[model samples]
Target: MAFWTYMLKCADGHFYVGHSDNLEARIAAHQSGTIGGYTHSRRPLELVWCETFGSREEALAAERQIKGWSRAKKRALIAGDWDLISELARCRSRG
Candidate 1:
């Protein structure tokens, strides 16, 4: 069984980070608003990024880490700008 850490770009232009064992089904639920939570009202989500993990714990950890990231860091991740992400992390740590 594969676990996944995913990020969604919501209709409101905000990002939602989560982990799931069933990425497709979970995304479908969020799209349909059946999950009923943060992404519920912010429907019409676009999957901006995702990564498969060996375990649920790994996926959950990734989700938690991403959830705590600044919007710029998140955008850098979505854009696959590793250098920028590193720079942002250093900036955050120095503050």
Candidate 2:
């Protein structure tokens, strides 16, 4: 199965990270308000970023890793700021 790591831009100008084997269906569910909880309170989320992984383990690992990033970092990611992303990842590796 194909797994994806996804990012959502919430109403509060924050980002959410999640992984799923069915990216399209999961996004649809979230949009429909069926995927309740933290995101439910911040509906109308926009899919800003996503990456495919060959395995669920990799997708989940990336999700966990992204979850710890700062807002600016996440924004950089969504904006496809490859330079910033690379720099941040490098710094993370050294720390």
Best by TM-score: 1
Candidate 1 residues 41-84, lDDT tens each?
A: 99899999999999999999999999999999999999999999
Give the least accurate 10-residue stretch of model 1, judged by summed lDDT.
34-43
Clashing pairs in 2: none
- Candidate 1's TM-score: 0.98
lDDT of 2 by residue, 1-95 (tens): 78999999888876889999999999888888899887887888999999999999999999999999877789888899989988987887899
Name the candidate that leads on lDDT: 1
Model 1, residue 47: distance off in Å is: 0.4
